[model samples]
Target: MKNILLILIFTSMAWGETPHDGMHHTHEEHVHEKFVDGKKLEVDPERFDKFIMDLKDTQIAIVNVQGMVCDFCARGIEKIFKKDINVKKIDVDLSKGKVLIAYNVAHEIIFEDIRDKILMNGQNAIDMQVIDL
Candidate 1:
């Protein structure tokens, strides 16, 4: 009876349904679909250009960044700014280690968030300014 009970317990443990198995399988399928059909969406070049122009026109403030030592450093800073939904346009000069950030008025502008993001990415946020326009 003892041996039979042990066998049953071991069998149950071996055959137990794992909740994570199905989740991982579904996640892989979702990733595959994203990689396959994600590139099919077409973007109009004129519309895209206009979208950028519109963003530039709506910028309320600019943040001048510093401590960007090299191209890799500037690229890192650019990548962080790209994550911000409020940032419209980013102009970075690797040689000068400066960044000009243009923000959209339609979105809630938070210079602190931008500053924090750049600093967190191992750079400096030098100055903040209202757009001249």
Candidate 2:
């Protein structure tokens, strides 16, 4: 019975399903289909594609940043912003040193909050502005 249970658990995990359904494991890695410049493009795998797809009506808050030189830095930014209840999604453009945040206006998040978050994460915040999407 023990061996059979172990096998079942492993099999479910292998198939990207956990014993607990539709919660923790739902954020498993997945690609996105996007059309850009009159051509179809596979979205960046490094991005938080699942969260972005769930955006309904959001505002884009662009934060000019610095000191993000690697994948880990981008991931840190992604994780930090995603923690905010108001932040629906985040895209960290490492090359441009910018973090694009999709936030719901109901929470009344401000640029200062984002700037402080960046400072806490050891990244420099250069500028921040918002645009309705």
Candidate 3:
């Protein structure tokens, strides 16, 4: 009887039905979407304003990213950029689906390099805006 019970449990698990399946499942109801130049983009204006204000006399890169749904995604992007000597600081906003990078005044803005770092974190860089402030 114990062997038979174990077999049934394993079968259920193999079929992708677990006891806690529904309990742990979560869905984010709020969809963050914006259209810029006929492309779907996600950004929070207030957050962007705040982020820009925090960096003084620095060049900022606002990268529109896809698949940044969790904190791990955010941290991964941050980690990759932090290794670059030109990057002064980095911030990832999952809600806005944007990665904000600050560079010193003399630092050059390289979109391909930024895209590569984001790609390393399993995300896509859809668009980028470089602001000289």
Candidate 4:
């Protein structure tokens, strides 16, 4: 019985489904370290201007996110936003703690939906700005 129990526990861990605090472990529960020792990346004004220029016809949403400290966090945000059909382009800047989303001009910006998606990625969308270009 003891060997059987040990085998079951090892198998569950190998499958990435180990129990934690009475709940099944999930990717979101994994901890991530800060990028660059938590130093904010300096934004180059010229590059930012180019990014805006490239999405001339789209409506851009600048979402200020919290807890976006690493590349993993950025990728999670990118994955969530890419699922939205209205999103034309998505960029996650961990240095600025922002998610820049270029949406189709015909689609209206939905703050609530954006907030929800960020939450799903284990981040908080604290503020948002919209610009039509």
Each model's TM-score? 0.50, 0.56, 0.63, 0.64
Candidate whose lDDT is highest: 3
**C-alpha displacement of 128 in model 2, angstroms?**
1.1
Cα lDDT listed for each candidate: 0.51, 0.59, 0.68, 0.66
Model 1 has how many clashing residue pairs?
Answer: 0
Per residue, candidate 2 scores C-alpha lDDT tens digits across 1-133 of 9999999998886532111111101111122333222322223434534435667666656567767788875676777777888877788777667677888856665666777777677777666645443
The window of 10 residues in a row where model 2 has the poorest summed lDDT is 17-26
What C-alpha lDDT does candidate 4 achieve relative to the native structure? 0.66
Candidate 1 residue pairs in clash (backbone atoms < 3 Å): none
> Can you write out model 1's per-residue Cα lDDT over 1-133, one digit (the tens) per residue?
9999999998886542211110000111222123133321122334324434645445434345556677765677778778877776776655444455666656655556667777776665654544322
Error of 1 at 17 (Å): 51
Candidate 2 residue 59 C-alpha distance from true site, Å: 0.7
Cα RMSD of all models vs. native, in order, equals 20.5, 16.3, 11.4, 12.0
Q: What is the lDDT of residue 108 in candidate 2?
A: 61
Residue 8 of model 2 has an lDDT of 93
| TM-score quality measure for candidate 1 | 0.50
C-alpha positional error of residue 105 in candidate 3 after TM-score superposition, expressed in Å? 1.7
State the local distance difference test value for candidate 2: 0.59
